[model samples]
Target: MSPRVRGEEQPGFFEVLGTWLPRQPWFRAPRGRLSLTRVGGLRLPTPAGDSDSRVFLELHIFEVAHQDGPVRISVPVALRSRPSAIAGKSAFIGKLTSPEHGELWVYDGAGDRAFLAAWIEMSRREQGSRNGRSRGRAHAGFAFGSPWTLELRRTGADAPKEGVTRSIVRREHADSQGEHDRDEIVMDLLRRPAGEQDELLESLITLSEANCEVIPKVLGTIDGAWKQKDDADDAGYWVSGILGVIREAGISGPDGTSIMRRALQAGDDLSDSARAAGRAVGTFHADLAGSFGAHPQTQEQLRIMTANVQSTLTQQWEQVRSEFDDDEAADLNEVIDLMRMQLRDADEPLMLQQIHGDLGAEHLHRTAGDAWVIREPEGLMSHALGLRDVVTVLISAADAVMSVAAETPEILRAAAEQEAAEAEQEGQSDAPAEPVNFGQWYEEFTQAFLSGYRESDADSAGVDSVFFRAAMLTEALDLFRRWRGQWVFRPSMLLQVDN
Candidate 1:
């Protein structure tokens, strides 16, 4: 049905829209139909030289549900004078048949490369402002952030557009071509009109593939990518390649053992096995920080983010503080302080470098050879606090190990294998299996790994012992968090000590 064109409101040209906005993938609404707050006549922006007034119509859409609930995105629509004859095939935005206006089309101008390109190119010049700004050499690194963040009335943050169409980065010495090609696609997905769910789903799959690739090659190995196939498409990528032989030994994915776990599991607690694992993470942090420091962000940015982080921690702490006895609260407080102090101390003013931003046990990878690895820096904050990465990863990993350390090696291994298999069955994946206690089996594993990390010319060791203790504490606590219900913390740590 064609959308209705009002007879009295005739303005040389007419554009038609429908109530079908809520179903779009790009629509950030949890559920709802679009209500036209204002539908204005199109204002042409072009080289028409004041001759042709064929302006594109604009629709400012407010977020709403199917006549109910709330949506996360602000909908603004600028539709062409008439649905382009070619609108039906557009990938990001598409055509809609309207009863009032005929077979018209809708396009998210922001998603259109023509519309997004200029904004991105322009933003390339604005590197952030900050002090103690890393004076050493650094790569321009990545420039990215959450494009379409949800805001509620309580926070008073304005409802944002559904998504960012694209982000641009200009390096220390480079042209303004966007650094990450995949990001534009991601931003396009962000800025897409909510109507196209299929594009969103496809974009998500591509994003997952990118995360899988970021794993360090030592952990991922040449075969790692191949082993990481549970989905049919991923399986195809692996099998079609001649290197598919890697998948035969093990699987990969969330369902399977990750390279980090594999690397950690391969060792017995021979001397420095644990420390070797630390090196993997530390080295990753170092590289990430170095790359980021070269392109510093202003302190104001960190100040804003740290406030958000503090609010989250304070809320969590208050709940736990009330529940805990003195000793437990103290312990919790101590760990929490380790995390909080970084933000608090930075108040005086500090340098801004990139961090893994989202680090955890899952992101830490291991290989079959007892090679501890850090990976999947998903929240790879180019402008972030470096310590946050270390703190969060350690805390998260500790939470994991604390719970699982008590189980017998065999039981744990069997469970891991089963979980890996189940993940594969459900299209989840783990990593290639090596000796669960690789430290004992291979005497040189720890030494060799540390040697490689220490010898690397790319980075140097600058982490303070305080972070090491925090790392250890977090590692230990992870065990506690996991084992808290099944077994007492002491029993597990005392018994099935992780090598």
Candidate 2:
């Protein structure tokens, strides 16, 4: 066994993580040096009958102090005797030289198969044990369903023999017809543990219980407790929730590639797919509402939401106004004024319900049976306008189409010439016109999505067009502000069709 150093004696592990954590995509540290202190953690034993004794699995929670504030980060690490080629260099955290273990290879356990296998085994073993009970305290235990790995490995014939009649059975039967059928599972590690108040696990349970087939099934979850620095109790006092696991039935691919990009690349019409996605989202929303219940927004709530939107509009305009020229500025100002007017006119009471806070085309995936399944529904809002989710989807679809259009040779050349001309003229004119087909494509997608949404939940379909338009404009301006002076495209181009 590798020597486990405690407190100030563990310089190698802490130093390596301090340098590596900031470079990660999920690490949300501010733009400066960070002071990382190990707050709390748990170590899990390897799976039964495993011969690799040198490999150790641990979930460590660190209190990362930056300029802003302290952020708790949960890092699941797999310490191995040698470098892991399968986990690849991307998952490699850094080499740790331990006195007893010599050179140990440290990797992010979220990507390591061994770590995953061990985690699943632990959860399964602890399912009915004393650690599995929910005590309404910090030390609530494991909650899980049937093991997804075993289910995935089962053949259709075997399932029927066992009288199993699930959607997964149908999915497996379809997979048996193809030679490329492989078992893949996707796990989400909460970088910032939210303790028992974590909405993701609750949302997953709600959706799963309601038979919401549009999402991945909840396989298992490990809820652990850790001690914070400010805890007044003992050292090992359980204080936080740790990890969640879900079974991913869809085929995996590159993260940046969305369904829209795939459709465009294959030159396939996405109207049908868009409609299906819309229906899936609608069903998801309906299920969420049925589980959590929806309420009509109060006048005060409406007033506050409108004020926030207007404030965002003003702030974004102030930040990006310098990027636009005289003509472009006037056009943008017109859009902002229209948005304000629409906000004022949008006084109709809307239903406030649990919503998928960050819905986009990228989060939508197709399973082996070509059914749409939504992934990464982590950002669940307890009470928000369902239109917010719809608007986000619409904007994402438009952005996808715009991205494809921008890549075409004609549009690229036009953009280049326009940029050169604008430089020469000192940003005096408007942006170049969009491609002729761009508006049509965006319109087709929008209509198909709304149609699907309406078909699923007619009551939620009474969306105020003026409010939707205002929300779209607000989202576009927010995107522009986030782009941070990248003048490749203007927000005006996005709203030209609507205008």
Top candidate by lDDT: 2
Q: Give the best candidate by TM-score.
A: 2
Worst 10 residues of 2 by lDDT: 156-165
lDDT of 1 by residue, 1-499 (tens): 2343332233321123333444454554443334432211112122222121332423232323344443323332334445433223332244444345443335554433222322222222222113221111111222233221111001011112334322221222322332232222112213222332333223223333333223322110001011223344753321111100000001122311233344344433433544455566555545554433434436776477567666665664564354445775676687667667865665444345555676665655444444554534323566544555545654554444433334346656786777678778887566635445422322243344335445432233223323333443444444434454332222112123333
- Candidate 2, 299-382: lDDT as tens digits: 998788778878877786777788666887887788778778877777777788888888887777765545577765546887
Model 2 score (lDDT): 0.62
TM-score of 1: 0.37
- Per-candidate TM equals 0.37, 0.60
Q: Against the unseen true structure, what C-alpha lDDT does each candidate score?
A: 0.36, 0.62
Clashes of 1: 59
C-alpha positional error of residue 226 in candidate 1 after TM-score superposition, expressed in Å: 48
Report the error of model 2 at residue 497, Å: 9.2
Off by over 4 Å in 2: 1-40, 48-56, 60-112, 125-182, 190-196, 231-237, 247-257, 261-267, 297-349, 375-378, 406-436, 464-499
Give candidate 1 misplaced runs (Cα > 4 Å).
1-18, 24-35, 38-103, 109-358, 361-388, 394-435, 438-467, 484-499
What is the Cα root-mean-square deviation between model 2 and the actual structure? 11.4
